[model samples]
Target: MTDKLLNHRAEGSTTAPPLLLGPSLGTSTVLWDTVAPELSATHRVVRWDLPGHGGSAADLIGPGATVGDLAVLVLALADALGIERFAYAGVSLGGAVGLHLAVHHPERVSALAAICSSAHFGGSQPWEKRAALVRREGLAGLAESANSRWFTPGFTVPELVADHRDADPGAYAACCDALAAFDLRDRLPDITVPTLLVAGREDPATPPAHLREIADAVPGSALVEIPGASHLAPAQCPQAVLIALRAHFSGGAKHGMEVRRQVLGDVHVDRAQARQTPFTARFQDFISRYAWGEIWTDPTLTRRERSMITLTALVAHGHYDELAMHVRAARRNGLTPEEIGAVLLQTAVYCGVPAANSAFATAQRVLAEEAEGTGG
Candidate 1:
């Protein structure tokens, strides 16, 4: 493992899960900036500049410096941060690293998310050829290729294209090599952690079929396609990506998005409330479309199960206001008192008695209010 790499961290509530994130090739933690706010609201999102990207050292070593090497580096980073176990999420090259960790060190990951990545990354000719160009000419040689793979047709920005072109060739080549060697086709069945495979409908690089293969291969893995988004789901459609990821990670996505919306409410409203600003008129769009449209529409899991997971997350993270609201929503969704009790009881062990106790009390209040209103 390289002894030096620049890791970027944004502090969210200390209560949420510690998510160790890995970035894509040639990009730093900046790739997560757009999506971090929504995620950080409920998770301690950790992103690092991989070996040759951002402020990290650009040392392209021998055979061992592969995606597996990056996975090892991330594990070491988690250890350094005192995170014994965490939920893992990554994109492209980063997703490949997450796969390695999930297969080799399952205990270290609580849940896993793979975005725009494949177990057997398609023909390595593209990446191999790019790596050679980087080695021979420099970062300038692989500019056009990176742009085509990274951005979709309509969304490609000239400045962003220029920036990628200007990135260090050595680092770019190193990442390409890692991508070229990544292959977990047979190992996906061994990953026990609950997994989420996200794809951009327009992602030409990995394509939807690649994500489908990952979902089918990984037991209990769920697949979600981000419409209109490219390989850079977080960057292209942050709201959609954020809702999908958070719903999956927090376990509220099972009952569909209506359950997620009821738990988190509208992101815009939640954001305004958190910041003590008045809710804007347009905030309703955030609730109707994102919180309800996408997530609530999926009907794979029961509302009761979704309630349990969402409540557990809220209690664990100490999101009291949302917890109270969800408690009411659970009741509206026909959750019984015993079920609510069970959720809180479970949280007592996973989160803590105090947080669970608070949730229970709020549940009682919400249930009582709901009963009285329904009776009226």
Candidate 2:
């Protein structure tokens, strides 16, 4: 069930749903080598090299190639491979392409996973300058910038350095140009695909804020930040990334929606009823089946354990309201006072004392309510 299509090839389980994976800037399908084996164990993976970047072909669409154009090439590759509907995952530029496809051609993309990417890459003069350099002097001129953003100084290796050096200048420049003109900020609301955004905590280029913007812009998209990792999170933390991605696709919308509703409750439905917006009905449907049914239904962990982890995460992140509500739910999940205190103490060191203090205060208030209710 695996063969070369127009620009890509399929791998892994033939019976399982196919995953169309796109490469990052200046990388080839080979970039997925370290991670593909892990993903392919259960699902069919389709990895592709953008034109002029890898073994597929050396055709440069030039600096004028738009994100939309890259998306079209992806769709065509899927069509040529006879893949009607499949999950999509990409890194960096590849991630943006997945978003574009999910937005523009929803039916073709069953689910999405975007790593270290943004909805809008912005229009900065530095980007234009880099593109100009790549086009004129080739990828060599842009090597330092790419290296700085892609790898930590201490982790650089001979092979890794050579990989960047070996990249096709034309393809690198073309992708840089595409990114320069890419902007989907205003249109992010239209995306309905189940999406996951993964970013490195130490990533200087895309950063966690870029992932945060994506999560906020796309309703229901979950964001995961891996600590101690750089921009190459997929490579640095493949196991975590694959675990989340598989859970999303295999479980789909039904499970996640159910879990979300049980935890977040009818915040959506109540708001919908209050406003009666046209999207209200769909909103209710989405929460019930996807958030609650799929994600919550999984036996992976008890609702209580999940709640504790989620609350700890939000507290660590300084999302006060969300942290507060989850703190309340933690009691229902049977989280003990000591456990909550432990989470706070852990966050104090990693997430700052001020944030941990707020979380501890919120937890104390919720614990008092539990105590009073039991006493009454």
Deviating ranges (above 4 Å) for candidate 2: 1-6, 157-160, 252-376
Candidate maximizing lDDT: 1
- Whole-model lDDT for model 2 versus the true structure? 0.74
How well does candidate 1 score on lDDT at residue 328?
A: 68
Residue 132 miss distance in model 1 (angstroms) = 1.0
The most accurate candidate by TM-score is: 1
Model 1 residue 219 CA deviation in Å: 1.1
lDDT accuracy of residue 357 in candidate 2: 89
Which residue pairs does candidate 1 place in steric collision?
A: 257-295, 257-296, 258-296
Q: Please, what are the lDDT tens digits per residue for candidate 2 over residues 265-325? A: 5564355457756666556545554456655665898987787778778977789876767
- 21-111 per-residue lDDT for model 1 (tens digits): 7777767777787787767765788888776566666663333257878887788778887788999889888899899999999999999
* Per-prediction tally of clashes: 3, 20
